[model samples]
Target: MQRFGWLFLTSVGAGATIWCTHFVAMLAYKAGVPVTLDPVLTIISLIVAIGGTGIGFAVATWRQNRLCSIIGGVLVGAAISAMHFTGMAAYRVDGIIEWRWPYVIASLLCAATFSGAAFAALGTATLGRYRIPVGTALLVIAIATLHFVAMTALRITPLRLSTAPLDSTQMHALGLATALVGLVVIATGVFAALIDRWTRSDAMQRLHYMAMNDALTDLPNRAGFQSELARQLGVARATHTRLGFVAIDLDRFKEINDVHGHKAGDDVLTALAHRMRSEMGRHDVVARPGGDEFVAITRFDDRVQLVAFVTRIEAALKAPLSVGPFATSVGASIGIAVYPDDADNAETLANNADLAMYRAKSEGSPAPCYYDAPLDELIRDRRELANDLRRAIDENRLEVHYQVQASIATNEVTGYEALLRWTHPERGSISPSVFIPIAEENGLILPLGEWVMRRACTDAVGWENDLKVAVNVSPVQLAHADLPRLFHQIMLDTGLPPRRLEIELTETAIMADRDHALHVLRQIKALGVGVALDDFGTGYSSLETLRAFPFDKIKLDRLFVSELEGSPETIAIIRAVLALGKSLSIPVLAEGIETGVQLAVLRREGCDEAQGFLLGYPHAVSAAGPSAFIDGPHIEPLPDADDISNAA
Candidate 1:
């Protein structure tokens, strides 16, 4: 319907221009006779002109069929000729006016031929380069040829005054007015066409923007990022220069979004984009390729200069972003890859940078690191481990090995720390440290965590002395809103008492979103489950964490225990941590007591419980319940000087 309306308007405008042109040409006639127009005939001629032009425009715009264009153009030409002839009939002369047969036929033929050519040009692409110019010339020639031939067709036999005709000034004024009307009609049509074209172009540009950019940050999206990177890579290859690519991931972004809501997340992204742009040079490109992930491309002089540039940009992005009522802290983990150094192509460069970035994040490295070939093995190993881990979960091949946690005072097994162990079909024993993080990153943690919790609880159902089973909870698990519900559901399903389940996390995990983690922890505790802070005193503000949150146990980090005998500062910090836990009524467990000296020191220092190879190594906890612990925990006698070599 709308298209028809445009066609109608176009036809009317064209018709008006042609009608005015014919009227103006008629005014130029000097028949030497008093002639006045017949109003009815003149009005009929305009109606024919408008109708004819409407048919022509309808055929041209609706289809590209050549035959249709020719037919429509012929009808338009016929209507135009009818109007011309009809207007001549309206020219009532007081004297006889003779019409020349040849001139009349020529004028009629010229109108049809020129009009058909113009319409044919509109219909087909065959005219090639000459289409526009030739079509335009034909139009001018048509008007000129028709008007002059028609004038010659009219001959005045005598001069006589009739109805005073129109005075010379009035005739000239009418001619000027008709010419002005023709110009106005043409101008209006062109203006409308320009506006329509602009509107469509602008809409297309908007769609292109939507396709190429991230809506949240208004930065180039993944497609745009990859395209621009490839383009830059071409330039670098051509010039034999180096290109630096950084894959950056904003840390704790999920926690921010989960704790503060999506609006805060968007605010952080926008601020980060602005910071990136501000810190980058004109040749640099920054893009938000995905959620909480940003990539940058820049030219570099060398590896050192690339590192320096990345460090500066990373530093700028570390500034706090204001999100509504409070300011949120966010930091980035960057992985750098250089062309001709780390990779030969854009895809490899991007992948290597991403791998490096994840490594920095997973290892908790403070500085951005360059891509190294040795790191590729670690990545491949993790990937293979992840695939195996998935199969381990599916094939019921996942096993739980319990490390005995003993009472230092009684020297008896108190409870067991259930550790996940995957003995891959090909790789044998794959460490939890390697596979667990990979699971978290690949989103296998949810199912893996559920299976571990359920299996551990199921395994501990009927233990001999009712020993508790402690399970480590990742920050990923804590971030889940359904974590508490899932835990209780698992408890119900396994029929294992909630009190027997101990969920351990670190100070850093709780600090991710202290209020949320605290809430989740308190809810778990409300269900009679124990919440312990694992790897305590290893992260920032261990004292503050202990003071602020309710914790049933504090597991001293293994590193501090290994360093205890060699470093006095370590012993001092250990004593301080023990003192803090004792004052708060929280039992402190020393981990990694490989040597008897370390165990004896932990005992002397009033540590409540301890676990390591010295006291007990991780052993497969049988589903046969209490017999697993009844078999007795591993124990080490006081180490002799000779035993120091095997302590680690």
Candidate 2:
């Protein structure tokens, strides 16, 4: 409706211009007879011109096609002819008049031809910026030709005596009134055009702002930050100054999001963004690229200055911020890269900073880490290893080794835990710890875990004894794959009974998403597959996890077992976990039993099962057959329970 108003204004202005031109030309005529206009007819003609042209312009605007433009142009020409003829009818002259049919036909034809051409040119994109001017020029030619030719088509002979018409003063007064109205109409059209342009400009600016800013924080988003960084870099280059790029990651932010609702998480992020902005210098820019990650660009003179700035930001971020009903604190792992010192370009500098950030996170460094060239090499090496692992999985070069889990009292092998072992033809054997994290990070764990499960099931099905096979599932795998369905399918494919298969997952995996993990575990349990909480007492909310899931077994982490010799605290935690498991009717399995003393202590503590090198080392399926344990490591006999307690 508003856009149509502009068109209407334009039509009124154009119509008034045409009407005024005709009347002024009449007033300029040098005929000897006196003449005056019919006021009623003049007003009616003005109405016809405005209404007709308005419809024409509206039709043209509604569709930008050649046919519509031509039709619109015809309407406009017809309106002009109507207004001219109607105004001429009001011309009260004492004369005899005659029309030239050929000249009249030629005038009408001229009006239609030029007006159609004008509109058609306006619709042509090839006309470029000259379309409007060209269109206006042709329209003027059409109007002028129509008026002059129509006048030439008429012949008037003056009477010997003139009838009384309006005096010169009255005629001049009427001309002045018409001129005033035409000026008012033109002014109205100009006002509408100006308003429309201003409104459109304001809307465009708003859209640009939305594109460049984060809606929640009203801060510059990644794109906006990059643009600002580029501009700042240009300034720094001109002035020969150094710029620092700091990449900040909120530690355990995913835990926060998973534990609390996303709304609370959003609140936490919003608070952090505000606090970060407040901590920055006026010339510095801070942006939240996505998902608990933020970045800042600041100018610094030296490393010390940059470090001080980063420290301030870290302190500010670590401070408690309010979120909804309560306040929560979050830690930041910041990585810094200096311009010209680290890298010359933006992309390289940003990558260096991100590499450093991951290093800080991995090292658990409280202070910010600066980019070092070695970090880049390490990342490259990891990426190459990831590619190799992908190829290894594809080629079936990976192998599964099994370590026996046995009853504490009888020393009878009850089950075996499947451990993945990778040996690169060139790199020899690779530890699970070294490549497991890489697998998790690079999303290779899903397929790798499936392979291990299927292979373990196939190997276990061929075992002489009906022993269970346990496989470790990473947190990434638990979160992504449909474990129950996969387990069922793998068991069917390998012809292994569900009751003889078990999945060992860490508390950290359950803590990542307790409800979802529990739901999946229940479904797996319904299929008769066992689920054990592996690496117990190492993650947050251990007691809560035990209470939530009805685990078939609890595997005490190797860390606790390793620290049992001198750490009374380790003994107390182990005792408590064992007691809790016993009370819940869930058997406790202690892993990492390298020494006879560790086995004796766990046996004294009433641990149900144990697995480590002391009992049997992990070996390939062929080496780990039923009779393979005949040559296992020798174990020292346990002392009296009271003596063991006294020694501890």
Candidate 3:
């Protein structure tokens, strides 16, 4: 709106000046003066008027110097004079008429009046400082001088008795006076406009600073920081220089605010800003992005220079601060990201820096760390997997590959654990370790998990009556809104008995939201679906949580199973867990068994069931149940320490 107002004022002023100048010239020609050179004079007047008006308008629009307006006025007046003089010279009257003194005097007076008026108008429009009274006085004097000069130039041929003799001395005196007055008028108008423009420009500049700068520390604020960051990034990219941005979050700043009050906090922030400014180079930018958050952007020759710069800032921040009467110290954990390295743009760089800063804060380190490819790759891979998992839902690429669980006493398959697998088109056979967390992070587990549940149920319905299929559910999936509805749909779609479908959840999955998890588990249990606690020994191993949710079985983590024979402590812990599960009427299943000795120990400890490579390696869904590996002399158990030492 302000810009439009400036344009409107300039265009109207220019048009008005051009029209008025032409109208006055026409009027002059109509007033009995020879207009032989009127066309050429008018053309000159039009150019001068348009050019002066354009210059004045431009100066006003830019809010530049008043000298521009003054110069414009002077040019306009000079142009008018030159045009009038040229027109007078071009006069060619083919008659016996006398060159009257009155006619010459009138022409000069008219020229002076027109020139002075135009100059004064331009000056007043452009200059904000000078008063109108002084300008008017100058204009009057300029008009009087022009009239006198014109009269002096006149000569009467064939002088009548009424015509007094032309006095050269008087005429010369009059002409000199007119020239002096005209010069004074133009000079005054120009000078006044220049002074006015200077004063207003200074005032505006001060206002602009106040608006852009922070009040407390007089540093740039968040908005200003964004603008500066963009500008600096552009410069760095153009110059092929390294641009570094560091996001600094003051450690324990909240404590200071809580103890000393907000006023003291403000004082500390101001002092800190001063210190930061002292530490920064002239080309660097430092800004307070938010409460207790400061950001710095600097150009460096390379990564090493950027690291050194960050180190210096970290060192400076470690120094003690004196806020009011209290001497306090605070440390800052800074996250450093370089342009065209960590990110290609401003917002991405800032976001990545913030991520790195949080990582630093979590690690409890004051030292700066550069953004590494591994971290970016980890995030990128997770995002890609999340997207792929979503597509897998539509394409039916997600499947539950079965691993047989066997009973040692009967040497028969009790059930099969349904492990989820994804075969990506480009990157084939993605591991559960990689995509499972991704699924949880992106909430893709809800739909993918539902599909797993439905597929497992359908597979189980086709299998022998005794074999059950256990499908693992992520914590996010368990917390889903339609969990019970999904279970019911799966049972109906597969025409599988509810007892044949078992849902497995980790300790973290159940403990994440105990009430919600328990409620969902109870709903499934009510439908006659068995619920197993997967990886029970790891995560939140609370007896209260176990008692809250009525789990049908507890699958011990592979970590505990792997060390059971080597560590008596691990064996004892597993025994206790197994005893607890039995007491609670929950069957304990040992996982990752690899040899007869481990299997024998689990059996001796009275474990109910086991699943591992020793029993059967995980197989495709189309494969038959657990393979039979009889306990014979040819199939020797893994050697113990004594046997190995004796052999050596």
Candidate 4:
């Protein structure tokens, strides 16, 4: 429509220029001037025509309304006519011809009629909307028809250049051609506009979809999940049906991603999404709310169906998945909350389910657990414990206990491993195995670890200078930015030489951030302190980890030492590890040496030191002094041959 209006304006302006130019040429001829066409005049006439057309095109393009386009077209035509007449009046004739009233009247009438026809075409084109080419063609036909009719009424002599008359057939053919051109032009303009609109709309729709979907899993994203949850909640309220929302998270997903590459992790998530979708009913909605997190919403007929449905989904997640070279087993811990039961709204329900899912993860299992008040209470207790842990170090409620490390060859005390112990005012004793991990997780280990190092160093100053004191360092503590400076300060404060302090770290700790760990270990070694790999065979330790760090000691995991007599594989693994340590100039210490046979085997395998209940149980600081416990073979003997055979 806009294009047609522009075309009409173009035609009207062109016709006006042609009529005015012809009338001025006739006037000059009547005045007895030699009517010779000059090159300058021709150029000026062409410029006027082209200028008028350009102005009309600009107006049509600018105005969207049909009426505005028509008015603009008429104004453009009047300007072109006036300019042409003014240029004609500039001519100097040889003699003056009388300005006859009849010629003047006829010329004015012709101008008015032509202008009216041009305006009519523009109005028609404008009414057709801005179909530029069609409007231009229509104006051309109308102007030609009006010009021929007005010419027939003129009293001037008609020129006959050939036998055929040039009036009727030529005029009719021109009109028809103009009309056809207008139709073609209008059709082309409309087609172009339609294509432009469609392409833009399709692009926008694709962008919208991309924004709402997860790139990795190709599932609805967090925004989409929230929208679906709100929609379902409304429907559930209206229909009085139960709506269940389950928040599911994969356990130890970060560990998997860290060990393998992100590409393998992505593949695992994609497979998990497909598995979840297959397990869900058609009406259920599943979405990836975030990394390794998925949410499901379903409208259940009753609570029983909801429970059964969640159970089925949990079982589906427990199945093993093959990713790249690894056959991995991943499980989902699901937390379910039903509408008007666990929560009445989306936010509350989602939050409560998330809290419950963490609780399920804390239980260390693959199962679905419904949200309840007890779980909330447990979370509160954990929070309290984290808060109280800060004061536990300052108030000296946390203390070090000594577990004796003895030489396997001589059966004499070599040193002691310093272990952290917490004695709660109200709860009595808390095991290091339990609270130590909690401290590491909640970021309390930075301070708690520093305290342990200082206390262990202070206590070791009391022991004989030849005996080493081992202090276990959690991975979180090892990752601390200021650990080197803190260790130096503790060494200065305790007046214990760096050689007397031995720091123990598990394999996982060294492998967690290999580069950073190496840098930290190098800094500690530069201070003349010894580094030991603790719980050596328990975690995913590549041979690279052992080769990278200069460990002074390797503590064999208790699992390998416990089954040494019963399983020949365990014994062989221990021996191989001991030999590897010797080859690297690192001493190997066997943990959990509880019997005579185990001790004898470790001694034969060239193990340097051992620590377990059979050696000496962890004792209080006062009982931790060198003279408090006996050190030689007479102190205690490992279990006899009968006991070892029965144990095996």
Q: Residues 69-183, candidate 4, lDDT per residue (tens digit)?
A: 6655555554444444444444333334334445444544444444444544555644576554555554554334433433343333223223433333423443454455445
Clash pairs (backbone) in predicted model 1: 464-626
Better of 1 and 4 by TM-score: 1
lDDT value for candidate 3?
0.70
Regions of model 3 farther than 4 Å from truth: 1-232, 237-242, 245-335, 340-369, 373-395, 424-428, 479-482, 538-540, 564-574, 622-648
Alpha carbon lDDT of residue 623, candidate 3?
53
What's each prediction's clash count? 1, 0, 1, 13
Candidate 4 residue runs with Cα over 4 Å from true position: 1-167, 255-260, 324-326, 380-473, 477-523, 527-648
Tens-place lDDT per residue, model 3, 1-648, is 545544444434443333343343333332232222334553454445445445545543354445554554444444444444443443332222344666665655555455445445545645454546555455444434543455355442332332333333533443454344345445544554565587689889988777667889888988888889999999998999989999999998888898999998898889888888888887898888778888999998867777777777877778898888888888987888889888999998987787677667767876865666666455445566788888988898776778778776556677888888788999999999988877776667677787888877777776763678888888888877689888898789889898888888888877777788888889999999999888878887889978787889989889988887667788888889989998998988988888767777777778888888887666666554322222211222545656433322
Residue 335 in candidate 3, Cα distance off native in Å: 4.5
Local distance difference test, per candidate?
0.81, 0.85, 0.70, 0.72
Best candidate (score: lDDT): 2
- Residue-level lDDT for 428 in candidate 3: 95
How high is each candidate's TM-score? 0.52, 0.64, 0.47, 0.47
Tens digit of per-residue lDDT, candidate 1, span 169-194 = 64665667677767768887987788
Error of 1 at 448 (Å): 2.2
Say which candidate scores most in TM-score.
Answer: 2
